[model samples]
Target: MKEGYVIRDQSLPHFLTVTIVDWVDVFSRKSYRDCVIECFEYCIKNKGMTVYSYVIMSNHIHMIVQSNEGKLSDLIRDFKKFTSKTILEKIQSEPESRREWMLERFKLATESHSRNKNFQFWQLGNHAEEIYSEKFMWSKIDYIHFNPVRAGIVSNPQDYIYSSASNYIDLKGIIDVEIVQIPVVNVLKSSSVVKYNSYEK
Candidate 1:
């Protein structure tokens, strides 16, 4: 709705990236990151948002998600709105060293946007790309899971506690994700084969 970014099919899984205002590393704190986790979990439980994979970085979150209720855009709008208010409140009440600086950035961001009032925590528009094929889906998933590794935060993707890679590897993570099995036509075996069989659970 913001221009080129369009959720053509609300029911299909989409790779979404939501960034913080001024690229602020708000999620550098576990408490703030947990706030995002809580909101995603709530959406999964109550809003029929099926999350295939997700990773929370220092300033942004990348998620592969689809809405069962055909309201992906609406879900994202509410998610941004809620997280903005919740995180701003946390920054105000909590003992944050960068409290004033962060609030000022939020205030400036709000002033730049007419729709926002007082403060703006997240940047406008989600960089969304719909998954049209198994290759594309896996590519995006790998990108999301390996973000922390690419950023030199961890040696292995699974070592990042804020990503769904742990869950894919049969390890416990911040939250459980719905693993989508990719079906491939194997020319070697001359049959269709499924990858990620361990994720059947």
Candidate 2:
């Protein structure tokens, strides 16, 4: 039996945040962080997801996103699967001297969860809470940027190179996700809209 439950809403746009196991400082390691970024970039280009904002914390990730032309659940699932496998392999195959101890520790943690493999990169289902309201959306965005600061890792959110904070703050650029915010009119109107001009009696 799966320990986590899935949440879905066909009525409104969705935003999801996922955390790591035991809050282990995964993002502190460059290899693991790079793997995550690789996966996210692949998804945006290949999958039909519009990733708005994202931040990589010590042990978690916050993403403001919605599927543009695909199922959100499927996209998330593939991201997790592909990242876990590729990252684990990258760690195992790397010639870096420092990675040996880190890889051993990861192996130890994955022992209980490994079904038929040597190691496991991530735990079970990622906890998700849908963002429906404007306040909630902004709150999550701020929370994502502030995660590294709260952990005492970086002084400024923009200094954290693994996040979309710099892009959001400067409106300059992002690696995988686009930083453009949906206009109020876009959110309020249906997919097909001829014009915003209107008159009422």
Candidate 3:
């Protein structure tokens, strides 16, 4: 296991989340935050990456995405590459006198990775799991939304501005997108469950 995260996967539809080393909250920057948006937009537009749910935390990001073309890895790689380049370039090129310290911090943090020519905006090998059932999917989704709330960053899931919870709860500032909305508790209802044993993974 690398970085205490099990990096095993051989298929699509993997629920994925990644964090900066030491959980440094790099996403707190507005330009860095927009890098993520641009990456997702790129994947959605060109890679057939269907996003089910997402939550952008201060240091990490949780997303449930599936690629129909079996190119999930390619999509993720490009997204990370694009975001890192854009965010790092933005921080390095900021001419504001007060922002010089921030550039220093980024440069120091990324010094170890030879793969990166400069600032490494994200760490390698994201934590990911296959959503095998309704229960798994619901649990992951709930875990994501409840993160900020449990951390006391927000009182309610909907109060966190950078998450899908706001979309699920108050239908707040998120852009419209198609999603396969699954119920949280219906998986526990055995009577309501439809067993399709005829299907194969």
Per-residue CA lDDT of model 2 for 1-201, tens digit only, reads 384646575323455666654555656678788888888878778887677778877677778777776477788878877876776677668755546665666677676775626655566675666777755665666677767778797877777888887776655544855654534665555221111111000
Candidate 1 lDDT tens digits, 1-201: 255788889888899999998899999999999999999889989999888999999999999999999889999999998888898899999899999999999899877688888988888888889999877887787778778878999877787889998888765777768876654466344221232332232
Residue-by-residue lDDT tens digits, candidate 3, 23-52: 776777766777787787778887788776
Between prediction 1 and prediction 2, the one with superior TM-score is: 1
Q: How much lDDT does each candidate structure score?
A: 0.84, 0.66, 0.68
TM for every model, in the order presented, reads 0.90, 0.75, 0.77
Clashing pairs in 2: none
The worst-scoring run of ten residues by lDDT in candidate 1 lies at: 190-199
Candidate 2 global Cα RMSD: 8.1
Kindly provide the TM-score of model 1 when superposed on the true structure, using C-alpha atoms.
Answer: 0.90
- Most accurate candidate by TM-score: 1
- Give me the runs in candidate 1 sitting further than 4 Å from their true place: 182-184, 187-201
Instruction: Quote model 3's TM-score.
Output: 0.77
List the candidate 3 regions with Cα displacement exceeding 4 Å. Answer: 1-11, 95-112, 171-173, 184-201
